[model samples]
Target: MGVCFSTIKVSGSNSNNNVNHNRKEATKQQTKTTKATAPTRKKQEVVDHQQNNKNVNNEEEKKLKVKEKQGSKAIPCGKRTDFGYDKDFGMRYTIGKLLGHGQFGYTYVATDKANGDRVAVKRIEKNKMILPIAVEDVKREVKILRELTGHENVVQFYNALEDDSYVYIVMELCEGGELLDRILSKKDSRYTEKDAAVVVRQMLKVAAQCHLHGLVHRDMKPENFLFKSTKEDTPLKATDFGLSDFIKPGRKFQDIVGSAYYVAPEVLKRKSGPESDVWSIGVITYILLCGRRPFWDKTEDGIFKEVLKNKPDFRRKPWPTISTSARDFVNKLLVKDPRARLTAAQALSHPWVREGGSASEIPIDISVLSNMRQFVKYSRLKQFALRALASTINEEELADLKDQFDAIDVDKNGAISLEEMRQVVFSLSNL
Candidate 1:
C-alpha cells in the first residue's frame, strides 16, 4: 500500500523570509504584552489566551501520564476484560528481535521452548482494538488461518495466545522476504514471461483455493506474499488476511477495502466478491511482466480512476516484445466486466499460464465443451429463425442486422470465423 512520491523543494529565500516574519510577529506580540495597560481589552484577551494554553498543557501532561500507566499495565481500555484463551505464552516461547510492525501490532521472531523451533509471533496491542469489530477481525483472522492450515501456499498457523494486554498469534516464519522485495531486486524490475508465469501460477492457485473455501482476500498484493526461503525455487506463501472475509455465495462486500493500485472496478463501485481477488491477481501479473503498474498516478484517487476508466497499455516497449499469448492472458484477466473476466481456476488453465507457460494445448474441461456445443446448437436454431424473419422484412430492417454482424467480424473479412464465434461463446458461457 506504500506509494513513492517525488520530493518538493522550497526556495531558500521564501523559507527564510517566512521564518523572519514569524520571529518579528512573535517579538511584536511580546512587546505589546509587556506594554499593555492594566484592565485593558487586549491585556484581558492575552491573559485568557495564556490561561487556555496552561490548561491545554496540563491536559496533555495528564494524557501522557495515563498513557505511561497503560503501558505499564500492558492493557488497553476495553469493555471486554477477558479473552477465553490460554495465557501460557511466556512459558512456551522465548520472544526475540522485532521482525516488523503495523498499525495494530508488531511481529517478532520467537523460539519454542519445547522443540527450539523458530516461529513468527504477531503481538497485537489490545489498546488498538478499541472497536468491537476490531476484536472480531483478529478472531476471524485466526479462524481463517486455522482453517487454511496445511495448504502449501498458505502460511502455517501454530497457535493463538492472549496475555493481559495483547493477543499473540504464532505462525510459520518466512525468511525469504516479500514478493515485492524480490521483484524490486530483479535486474530490470521485471520477470521474463516464463518466470512471471511461474509466480503468477502460484498466486492463481492461492486465489483459487481461497475462492473454493468461500473466502475473499480483500487485499491481494505482492506485499502479502512471502517466499519460504532464499532459494531460487522457494515456495511462495500468502500472508496477512486482515482485510479478508468469508463471503457467502452470490453476496457482495460493500466496504471499500484493499490497496488502491490493485483494487477492482466493482470494488470502487461498492460491490465486490471473489472476482475482486482475481482482478488483484491480474494487477500483480501485469506488474510482474511489465515492471510498472498497469494503472498508476501520484495519488490513490487518481489510481482508482485509472483502474476504473483506462485499459492497460500493451503497445509500450516491453509489452510490444512480449508474446501474443501473454498479452491475451492479461487482457482476459483485466476485463472490466467481472463476469467476462477469467476466474482463478480458468486463469490457471489459460495456455500462457498453465504448467508455467509450457502448456501447448488448451485443456477444455468436458463440461465446458459440452456447454459450448449446446450453445452452438442454440445459436444455429436462432439463426434459422432470424433468417426466416429477414426474408419477410425490407432492406431497412436488414441494415440493422448487417451492422451487428460487422461488429462481430473483427477481421473485416465479410464473414465470421470460429475464432470470432469462440469469443462470443466465451463471454456467454461466463454469464
Candidate 2:
C-alpha cells in the first residue's frame, strides 16, 4: 500500500508559484550591498598571467585573473551558470516551461541541450536578492546533492550554475505534487499502515547514507520528502539538501533553522547533528500515522514550548486498534534520548513492516494511476484494503508494513499510514 510518486501527475498550476516563493523565502538570504562593478579581467585571468611569468611581483597580484581556460566551462558536480535572468523577472530559464515558483526562484521543465531529455530547472539570483543566505545555501545543496545521486530516497540534480544575476540548477523533476498538498486535500482516506512502513524503510536507508557521508539535512518535512514514482510500486525520495551540512566528524552547527512544526529541539537551540534529521523524520512519520501533526500549536510560542518540552501526545492519537508493537516502534523513534532511539537500520528491521516476517519487496505498481479518476478508484481500493488488513496482520509486523503502504499511496490522502493501520487494528480488537 505504499504511496507511489508515479500515481500522481499534477498538471503544472499557477499555485506552483507559491511553492517557488516558499523555496525562495526559505533559501534566499540577505546579501551585503556593494557598488556594482563592471566585469574586469577575472581573477582567473591574472592567475594564468602569473603562471607564464614568475618574475612578477608576488606581493600585489590578485586571484582568478588568468587567461580563460576552455576547461572552465562546467565542473562535474561543481556549480556552473549557463542561464541568465529576464530583465524584469530577475532570473530566466530558457529551456523549459515554468512548472513551479519558490519565494526566490522559479522551477522549470527544462530540456538538457546536451542529452535531449527534459529536466527541472530551479532559478536563483545571487547578488540582488534580498535574502543573503540563498547563494551559499544553494551552493552547498548542489555539492551535497551531486554526491547523493544514486540513493533511492534523494532527488537527482545535474548542472548547477551561477550567472551574473542568478543561479540555475537543472535536475530530475518529480511531477507529482507535494505529499503535504495531498494530505491537506482530503482526497485520500483509506491508506494503510502497510503503506507507511515502506516509506519509512526507504527514508531510513537514505538517512543512514547521509549520516555516513557526514551530511545532515537540517530541514526534514513532508515537502522535503518527495515521491519519485507516486505509486505503491515505487518509493519516496528525500529532497532539498539546501539546509544540509557536511560537518567534520563530531562537529555541530549553531544556526537556528528548519520548519517550525518539524524543527527539533536541538535545531531551535542551535545545537544539531544527524539526529536533528532523525527528529524531523519522526515528526513526519507521526504526521503520516495521524491525520494531524503530533505537536500542533496555534502560535509560534506554543510550538516552541511543545518542542522544548519534548512531550508527544500519544494518548490523544486516535489509534485504538494500533498494535502495541507498532506504537512501540514510533515511541522508540520519538524518544528524547538520541542514544536510545533505533538507528535507521534498526527501525527497518521492525516487524510491522515485514510481510509475514520476511523482508518484502517495495510495491511499485501504483505508479500507473496518474489521472483523477485513477486516483479516486485507487482511494476506494485503499480503504477496502485497510479494513481487511487490520484483522489479518501480526502486531509486530506493523512497523515494516506501514511505510510500504505510504510509499505506494503517493497521494498522501491519509488513506495509507502506520496510524491508519493502527486504527483498523483497533477496530478489529474491539470486535
Candidate 3:
C-alpha cells in the first residue's frame, strides 16, 4: 500500500509559530549538545582572543586596524561581499512573501520576471557575516549548489546575486512541505516497505552524487529534504548546504555537525567522512521503516551516547513485519564502524532499497506514525520544560556552582575539559 499525505491544516492556535519556535530551540540545543563531545578548538580560540585583548598595545591595535582595512579592500564586489554573480536582482526577479528566516537572513518566494515562474530566494544579510568563516560558508554553499544542481534529486540553483547589503540565492521553489511534515500528515502515518524503498532510493542517490563530487552533506535530516510539489509522487529534492564541506581523498572532517537524531557515531568522535552521510541516511531509513528514531533519548547527551553504544532495535513491531532484506539494508548502513558501513553507492544496490527489489507492498502498522508524532511532541515538551527550569535559575543562585566549576577547570580557561569531567565522575562514582 502506497502512503498518501494530506495537506497539513493550520489552526488559529498559532501551531506553526510553536513548531517554528521548537525547531529553533532544537537547533540551539543541538549546537550546545554537540559542544560537549566535539573538539574545542573554536572555544580555545575565544579564550585566546580574550587573553590577547589584555596585552594588545595601541600600536598593535592600529596595525591590526590597517590590516583589516587592507583585507576589506582586497575582497571583490565592493566591501566584504563577493558572491561572484551579477547584482541585477531588482531586474531579474520580484520578491514576494517571506517563506522563512534564519540567523543570517530570510527566505522569500520570488517570481522570475522573464518566465513568470516562482522560485525560492535566500537573502543572506552581509552584516550577519560576522566571522570570516561565515562568509566562506555562503560562498562554498553557492559553489557546491552550482556544481551539484545538475542532479535530479538536488534542488535547482537558478542564480546568485549580491548587493552591498545582502546576497540573494534564487532556486527552485518546493511547494510541498518538509519530508517530516509529509510523514506526519499521512492518512494513517504509515508506509509500506515498497513505499519506503522509493524514498530511501532517492536519498541514497543524492548521497551517492554528493560523495561522487567529494562533498559531505554533514546534515541530512528529514527537514533538509522537500518535495518539488504537493503531488503524491513528487520528486524529493535535497536542500540546505550550510553545513556541507568538500573532502579530499583520505581526509576526514573533524567538526561535529548535524541534527541530534541523525548524527553519526564517527561525527561525535570528530573524524567523520562521506560514510557519515550514509549513517545519517541509515537513521532516516530506520525512522521511515519503524516510525521511530533508532537512537534517541530525552537529552542530547544521552542521544549521542545511544548513537555511540547502542545498536538499532529491530525486534519491535514494524521491524518484525518488515522484510529480512530491509532489515539487512538498514543494518549495513548503521554499522558503528564507518569502514564496515555500506557506501552510498553500495547501499543503492542493496536488495531492499534497490529498484524492483524485495520490499513488501504491505503497509506498516499504523502505530508507527503515531509513535513518530508522539516522539516529536514529547521532544518539544521536554525542551520547553528545560527552558522553564533554566529561566528560573539566576546568576546569584549559580555563584556556588561557578566556584566548583572553576576549581575543576585546572587550566583556568573558563571551561572544563572532557578529561577533567571524566576524572571528577570517576572519583564520585567510587564514593
Q: Which candidate is the best by lDDT?
A: 3
lDDT by residue (23-55, candidate 3, tens digit) is 677778778978774667777888899778856
| Residue pairs in clash, model 3 | none
Candidate lDDT values, in order: 0.79, 0.61, 0.83
- Tens-place lDDT digits, model 1, residues 148-197: 89998999999999987789999999999987666445553333567678
Q: Which candidate model has the greater TM-score, 1 or 2?
A: 1
Let me know the TM-score candidate 1 reaches against the reference structure: 0.65
> lDDT, candidate 3, residue 6?
16
The 10-residue segment of model 1 with minimum total lDDT is: 1-10
RMSD of each: 26.4, 30.6, 28.8
- Pairing residues by index, what is the TM-score of model 3? 0.72
Error of 3 at 386 (Å): 12
| Residue 291 Cα positional deviation in candidate 3, in Å, after optimal superposition | 1.4
> How does candidate 1 score on lDDT?
0.79
| lDDT, candidate 2, 1-431, per-residue tens | 01222222243455456555544554443221121221234655787887757645542243333323223322211234333322422233356687655445677787655556767777764432322233456667788988998876777866676655567777787765666444334354445555566666677778888988888877877666666555546567787676788988767776666777778777666567778777777776666655456675777568877888857766653544445665776777776656676766676677865444432233212221233234335445865776577657653354246446555444454234345677667878999
Say which candidate scores most in TM-score. Answer: 3
Off by over 4 Å in 2: 1-94, 129-134, 180-189, 230-232, 353-431
